[model samples]
Target: MNQIRPLIPLLVTAGILIGGNGLQGTFISLRALQEGFSPSVIGLVGTGYNLGFAIGCVYITRVIRSIGHIRAFSALAAIASAASISMVLLIDPFFWFLMRLIQGICFAGLFATVESWLNARVTNATRARTLSVYRFVDLGSVTLAQYLIPTVGIDGFQLFAIISMALTLSLVPISFADRSSPEPPDAVRFNVKTLWQISPLATVGCIVVGLTNSVFRSLGPVYAQGIGMSIAAIATFMSVGIFAGVVLQYPLGHYSDKLDRRKIILVATLGSLAAGVFIAFVAGDSTLLNYAGIFFFGAFAMPLYSLCSAHANDHAKEGQHALVSAGTLFFWSIGAVIGPLFASFMLDIFGPHALFIYMAAVLALFLAYTVQRMTVREGVPAEKRTMSFRNLLRTSTFFNKLATPPSEDKPENK
Candidate 1:
């Protein structure tokens, strides 16, 4: 506790920032539905945000490099606060889409700034513990934000006002902190060929997880409303899944370290496939069953990104962890941008259940791919695996470059 005392202010800043961001995301989904936007349009709004996030990953490094972390973080937070309020003023679907895009960019920058700042403070001995605290704060705050939805009521302007307030409040701690800002991080590089040489299964797994997770994050509220859930129930539904992910991540990661990570991936994917089927076909009308299914689904699906990343790093040379991490994030972002649009289209044509159908199909395909890859390549020998876990919780390009050491040797395509 004493070791972490110095970092408390930054952690509080993260909590505030994430809480506001979480509320804004869920609020947008519900509010857009109330405004009579079609499912397809809501999906496009999600796609727009992810597209902007991807762009931010590519470019926010320059912004930080030019202005430095403290300035860049403040600027992005202001933009995010304004973007939250703008949604209320501009009620048009197209206008909201634009706002979401800007919000995504701001969020991408905010995450980069905060995470890079945190990474800078910790030494190698404290890296794991500090990252654990950071992850707990992030997931805990997001879950808490969901419960706030019922208090704010989705239809009122008050929620937007609250979101803006949170964003504004987040800046206070950082502004007053005594620590100096970290040097700007290098830009993330995406090298597909090198990643493939390291681990093909990990590459594909990142993309597949991105597709399934983004669909749920962006459109789950719409599905909940379609199934006649109340606002409070929607909050519970979303929060439960996220909470499940947080609770399960450590256990699953520990077990994966002991076995072939691909085996872990296959089992998790299979569980995800089953959960998707249950949600789509067997959980009708019983909200408890629906919630239970989502909880289990989150358990199995949410950690796959970290699993894939860990597996890739198992094969990576000592200095190449950062490159492998960056490549995986690049693929995940690509999938995130595409998933919501596809899921939304399915929702439009076949109703809410189609969301699960799309997810189940993706998981099934990934399952098959994982099985095939298992036959092709053996897992990294236990003696050869890296034991320390690195946090890849946020989709910040800067974090990837910072986590990875500079590498002179690049793997040729297999």
Candidate 2:
């Protein structure tokens, strides 16, 4: 606790920032639906946000370098706050899409700034514990934010106001902190050939996870409403899934570390398939069953990215960790951009249950691919795998630098 005391302010800021952004996604989806936007249009709003996020990942480092972390963070947070409010005033699908894009870009910068700031404050000795705390705060705050949705009421301007207020509040803590800014992060790099050589299963796993997860995150509220769930129920449904992921990630990841990760991936996919079946076919009119199904679905699905990342790092030669991480993120973002748009089209034609059908089909395809890959290549011997499963959780673009080899930690590399 004492070791983390100095970092409390930054962590608080992170919770507030992420909570606001998390609420914004679900709120926008519900509000857009209320305003008579088609699922396809709403899906494009999601796609636009992800597209901006992907582009921001490539360029945000330079912005931080030029302006310094505090300024960059403050600027981005201000823009995000304004963007949240703008959605209420504009009320048009195109305008909302643009605002979502701006929100995405700002969030990418905000995440990069906060993570880089936190990275600078800890020594190698404290890095692991500090990051564990960081991850906990991140997941917990997001879950709490989902529950906050019902409190704000999805049908009015008050929710947008609340979102903007949270974003604004996030800027306050870091503004008063006494620490200096960290050096700018290294530029992101992606080479598909290198990633594929490292682990083909990991590469495909990332893309598939991106597809299914983005669809749920962006469109789940819409599905819930379409199927006659109350706003409060929608909140519970979303929060429960996220909370399940937090609870399940470490256990699933631990098992993957002990066994062939490809096998674990297959098991997780089967779990997802079962959850989809329950949600789509068996859980009719029982909210408890629906929540249980979604919870299990999130448990099995959310950890695949970390599992895939760890598997890839298992085969990564020295100094290739960061590159592999970036490449995985690149593929995931590509999938994110495409996932919502396609899922929205399905929803438009086939109704709410079509969302799960799409998810199940994807999981089946991933399951088959993993089985085939198991036959083609051998798992990394336990003794040969160097990266820790816990550390693999930090491979998201926000913490990409931490995944890099120690030799590359020099300032000159940045």
Candidate 2: the clashing residue pairs are none
**Candidate 2 residue lDDT tens string, 1-414:** 877777888889988987787788888898899899999999999998888787777778789889998999889989989998988887898888888888888888888788778766766666767777777887888888887777767777898999999999988888766566777766666688899888888898889987998899899998889889999999889888777776677787888888887777888899988998889888876788989999999888888788888888888887777777778887788888899999999999999989999999999998998899888888887776777564343223657554434444343243
Q: Which stretches of candidate 2 lie over 4 Å from their true place?
A: 391-396, 400-414
Q: In terms of lDDT, which candidate is strongest? A: 1
Each model's lDDT: 0.83, 0.82
Model 1 lDDT, residue 385, Cα: 78
Candidate 1 pairs with clashing backbones: 322-404
